[model samples]
Target: MSLLSKIAEIEAEMARTQKNKATNYHLGLLKAKLAKLKQQLISGSSGKGGGGGTDGFDVTKTGDARVGLVGFPSVGKSTLLNKLTGTYSEVAAYEFTTLTCVPGVFKYKGAKIQLLDLPGIIEGAKDGKGRGRQVIGVARTCSLILIVLDVMKPLTHKRIIEKEVEGFGIRLNKKPPNITITKKDKGGIIITTTQPLKKIDDETIKSICHEYRISNAQIQIRCQATADDLIDVIEGNRVYVPCIYVLNKIDQITIEELDILSKCPHYVPISAHHEWNLDGLIEKIWQYLDLVRIYTKPKGQIPDYNAPVILKSAETRVEHFCLRIHKTLLAQFKHALVWGKSVKHNPQKVGKEHVLQDEDVVQIIKR
Candidate 1:
C-alpha cells in the first residue's frame, strides 16, 4: 500500500483504538509513526509526494523580521496586507483569490518588517490538500504569525487553522519546551527530570525513542511538556513562534461581538478595510518581536533619531552593533561610550562585549 494510504489506515486504527493505561504505549508508538509519516510527506520522500513546499511562493526574506498572515478563504488577509503596508495584493469578494505568497513591507519605529500574505489554507492543508503544506512551509520561516480571521464567520475556523499549522510542526504562541536529548554510543536510554512530567510518561518517551531508533540517549526534561513537544525535539523540524490572532471585518459585526472577540486571548479585533485598531496590532507585533534599537551618536554630534541600528535582544551587544554597521569597525575599534539603561553612569565607556539596550545611544571611539 502507498504511504498516504498506510497513513490513512493507521489513523483509522488509532481513531478506533480507545485510550487507557493498557493502550498508552501502543498509542504513543502510533503517534510517533504518524508523525514520522507526516514528516516524510512534508519532506517529499513518500510515494505520491509533491506537496510539502511553497514552490514559486517563496519570497526573499528582507527587513528585520518576517510575519506571515494565515487563515481560511476570503478572510480579508490581502486587504489587511494592503492596508498595513500599502502594497497592492489583489483583493476580491471571493475565496482563494490569493493563490500565492504576497510580500509587503511595513515600516514601524524605523524598522522595516516584512509582511507575507499567504493564500488561504483549508482544512486538510497539512496533508497536501490544496496549497496548504506549501503555504504552511512559508509560515514556518516566519518570525511571527498573524492568524487573520473574519469576525462574521464561525470562530471554529480559528481552531481548524490552528490544527493544520500544528500538524505541520508549527507551535503557535508557544516557546520551545525545556527539554534536552543527548545521544550516546554505549550508554542505554537514561531519563532525568528536575520536576514531575504531567503530559508525558517514561513509557511514552521510551516508545517514541524506540520508534525513532534512538537506543542510547540521555533525556532531560525541565518543564511540564507533552509527547508532541518531546517528539518535536526528536524530529528537529519544529518552529516555535508567537502568534497574534487578527480578527478582521469587525465593522460587519456588532459591538457586543467585537467586545467578545477582543477579550479572546492573543487576539486583536480590527476592520482591515476601515483600518481600525491597526495601531494596536502594530504595537503588539513590535512587542512580540523583542527588538532593540540603538541610536549611534557621532563623537561630536547628536544622535540621529531618524534611523537606528536594530538588533535582536539576544544579539544586542556592542560588538554586534559595530559588526552590523561595518566589519572593519571591530578591528579598528577601541571602546564604546554608552548612554542608556544598559550602563551605570551617563556615557560610560564599555568594551565590545558590553550588551546594549533599546533606544541606547552609542559612540564608537577608535584607537
Candidate 2:
C-alpha cells in the first residue's frame, strides 16, 4: 500500500474511535503513526522526492518579509495582488487562473515586503493532488500567509483551506506548544510539567513515545496541549506561522455582512476589484510582521530618515544591527549611540548587547 492510502486508513480508524479515558492511549499511538506517515509523504519515501522546487512554484525570497496569497480559484487573489503590489497576475472568472507563483513587491512603511501570488489549491492538497502540494510547499517558506477568501463563496472554504494547510504541517496563527523533549541514554521517560496538563495524560505520552520508539527521554510540558501538538514536536517538520484571513470582494456584500466579518479575528474584509480597504490590509500585514527599523547616523550628523535598516523583532541588538549592515562592521565597531524608544536618554551610548526598538536612531563609532 501507498503511504497516502495508509494515512487515509489511519484517519478513518481515528475518526471512528471514541475519545475517552480508555482510548486516549490508543488514539495517541494512532496520531503518532499518522504523523510518521505524513513525514514520509513530504520526504518522498515513494521515490518522487515529494514536492521539491521542480514544479517551479518556489520563487526566490526577497524583501523584508514574504506574504503568500492562498485560496481557491476565482477568489480575487490576483486582483488583490495587482492592487496591493502594483503587479499583474492573471485574473479570470474561471478556476485555476494562476498556474505558478507570481512575485511582486509591496513597499510599505519603508519596508519592502515580497508578495507571492501562488496558484489556487484544491482539496487533498497534502496528498500531492493537482499542484496543491507545490503551492503549499511554497507557502511554508513565507513569513506570513494571506488566506484570501471570496465573500460571495461559502465560508466553509476557509475551513477546507485551513485543513489542507495543516495537513502539510503548517500551523496557522498559532505558537509552538510549550513542550520539550530531550533524548537520554539510560534515563527512562521522565515527564515533568510546570502546570497541570488537561488535554494529555502520562499514559498517552508513554504510548506516543513508545510508538515513536523513544525508550528514554525527558518530557516537559508547560501548558495545555493535545496529542497532535506532541506529535508535532516529535515529527519536528511543522512550521508555526501567522496568517491573516483576507476576505475579498466585499463590494458585493451588504453592510450587515461586512459588519459580521469585521468582528472575526485576524481578518480584513476588502474589495480587491474596487480597491477598497487595501491600506487596512497593508497595515495589518505590517503589524503581524513585527519588524523593527533603525535609522543610521554618522558621527555629529543627523540621522538618515530616507533609508532605514530593517531587522526582525527578536534580533534587534546592536551586534545584530552591525552584522546586518556588514560582517566587518562588528569588528570595527566600538560603541553605538542610540536615540529613540530603545534608549532612556537621548543619544545614549550603548554596547553591542543593547537591545534596539522600532524607529531607533543609531550611530556607530569605529574602534
Candidate 3:
C-alpha cells in the first residue's frame, strides 16, 4: 500500500479502537506508528521530485516579528492584509485569489510587524493538497498566526484549519509538553514522573517508545501527560505558537452574535471589507506577541523616547538589548542602569545578565 493508504488504515484502526486502560497501550503504539508515517510522508515529499518545493512561499523575514494570515480561500485574508498594511494582495470574491505568499509590513507600539497573506488552504493540506505544504511551511516560521475565518461559519473553518496546521507539527496557542526523553546506550526504558500520571501509564509509554525503536532512554514526565504528549516529544519537531482567530465579515452577523463571538478566547471579530474592530485586532496581536520596549538613555542625556528598542519578552536581558543595538556594544559594555519595573530602585546598576521589562529606560555605562 502507498504511504497515504497506510496512514489512512492506521487512522481508521485508531478511530475504531476504544479508549480504556486495556486499550491505552494499543492506542499509544498506534499513535507512534501514525506519527512516524506522517514524518516519512513529510520527508519524502520534501525530497527530490516530491513536489514540496516552497518556491514562492519563501518571504524574507523583516520587521520585529512575523505574523501569518491563514485560512480557506476567499475568507478575507487578502482584505485583512490590504486594510492593515496597505499592501495589495488581490482581494476578490472568489476562492484561491491569492495564489502565493504576499508579505506586508505595519508598525504597532514601536515594533515593525511583518504580516504574510498565505494562499488559502484546503482540506488534506498536510497530505500535500492545494499547495498546502508550502503554505503551512511559511506558517511554521511565523511568530504568531492570524487564522482568518468567515464569521458565518467560524467554528467549522477554525477546526479544519487547526487540524491542518496541527498535522504539520504546528501546535497553536499551546505550550510544549513538560516531558523529557533522554537516550542512552544500554539501560532499558526508565520512566520518572514528578506528578501523577492521569492520562498515560507506564505500559503505554513503553509501547510508544518501543514503536519508535527507542529501546534505551530515560523519560521524565513533569506534569500530567497523555499519549499524544509522549508522541509529540518523540516526534520532536513540533512548533508551539500563539494564534488569533480573526473572524472576518462580522458586518454580516447580528450584534447579538458578535457579542457571543467576543466572549470566545483568542478570537477577534472584524469586518475586513468594512474595517470594523480592527483596532481590537491590532491590540490583541501586540498582546499575544509579548514584546517589550526598552528606551535607550545616553549618559547625562535624556532617554530616547521616540524610537524605543523592541525585544521579545523572553529575550529582554541587558545583553540581548545591547546585541540588538550593535554586536560590538556588548564588547565595550560594563553595566546597565535600568529604570523600570524590572529593577527594585530607579536607575539601578545591573549587569548584562539582568532581565529588562517593558517601557524600561536603559542607560549603558561602559568601562
Candidate 4:
C-alpha cells in the first residue's frame, strides 16, 4: 500500500479509538495529525509523504514506510536487522536460511521506518525463487528496499539481488539502499573461509556506489583518509534509503580493510555478537531517513497550549482529521479554528469536513 494511504488508515483507526480514549493526550494529538492527513488524501497529494508538490514518486497514506532488506542467505541481512532493531530473527550460516519476511521497526530521525527481512532472494527469485515469490508482496507494501551485501564478494553479490527485485516487478529509481558492510568489529573474527581482506581501489567502491546510485561528491581520490569525514559524506548521501554503514568485522580485517574502513561513510565498526557499533548504528539510521508525522487533538472545547503535535504525511481536510477524533464528531462537525502556522484560515465555521496544515493546532467546535 502507498505510504499516504496507510497514514489515512491510521487516521481512520485513531478516530475510532478516540471514543473511549477521549482524555488520552496522545490520542488528541494523533487526531490533530489525522486531520492533516485526511486533507492530504482528499487532495490526491498522497504520493511521497515529503512536504511538497503533487509530483511525489509514490506516497502512501500511512506514515508506515517499509524498508525491505533483501539478499542471498548468509549475507548477514538478518543479522543486520537484529543488531539494528533487536529483532530475534534466526541467523544461520547457510543457504536460504530465511524463507519469509520478518518485519521490525527501525527509527531514524524521530521517524519510524519499518524494516523487513525478506527471504534469501536467488537469481530466479523474482520469478519465485523456490518460494521467494512473496517478494512481490513485500515490494507492494514497502516504501523502500535495502539491498544488503556482505562486502566479501563486493559488487558480484549485490548485482544478483538487484536482478531478482526487478524481475519481481519492484520498480525503483537508483534509490540508494543503506548498503551496509555488516560485520565491522570482526577484524579477527571468523565466519567463513573467505580470503583475508585486501585493498580495494577507488573504482571498486565507486562501482558499488554507482550500482546504488550514491554520488561521491567529496573526498580526495589519491591521498588516504584515516579520518571519519569520508564516512559522514557517504552517510549523508542516504536521504531516501538506509543511511548508515555497519563495517562488519573490523577487528579481523587486514590493514588494507582498516584503511578503507576509516574513509567509508557512517561506518560503524561493530560485531553484532560483540555489540560494538550498535548505538552508532542506531544514531546513524535515525539520521538518514525521512518521516512525516501529524499532531492532533480531540473535538473538545480547547487544547493545551503545549499539547503534542501530530504529523500527517498527506493533505487531509481538517474535517477529515476531526473524523479521526470521532466519527460522530465528524457527523456533528462544525467549522474548525486553526491555531498554528503562519497562514491564517480563521475557523470559518463549517461542518466536520475541514482540512488542516502543518503546526495548525485546531479546536473542532462540534454541535
| Sequence-dependent TM-score of model 4 | 0.48
- In candidate 2, what are the lDDT values of residues 34-68, reduced to their tens digit? 88888888777222556444466748889989999
- In order, candidate lDDTs are 0.89, 0.89, 0.91, 0.50
For each candidate, what TM-score against the reference? 0.94, 0.96, 0.97, 0.48
Q: Which digits, one per residue and each the tens of the lDDT, describe model 1 over residues 20-97?
A: 777877888888999999888888732245654455686999998999999998999999999999999999999899
Model 3 per-residue lDDT at 310 = 94
Among all windows of 10 consecutive residues in model 2, the one with the lowest summed lDDT is 45-54
**For residues 308-355, what per-residue lDDT tens digits would candidate 3 score against the true structure?**
999999899999999999999999998889999999999799999999
Q: Model 1: which ten-residue window has the lowest total lDDT?
A: 45-54
Tell me the deviation in Å of residue 50 in model 4.
44
User: lDDT score of model 3?
Assistant: 0.91
- Per lDDT, the best of the predicted structures is 3
> What is candidate 2's CA lDDT for residue 132?
82
For residue 140, model 2's alpha carbon misses the true position, in angstroms, by 0.8
- Put down candidate 4 lDDT per residue, 50-142, tens digits, no spaces: 633222123243434566776667767788888777787788878877765676776554456677777776675543335445554455466
Clashing residue pairs in all predictions, respectively, total 0, 0, 0, 72
Error of 2 at 288 (Å): 0.5
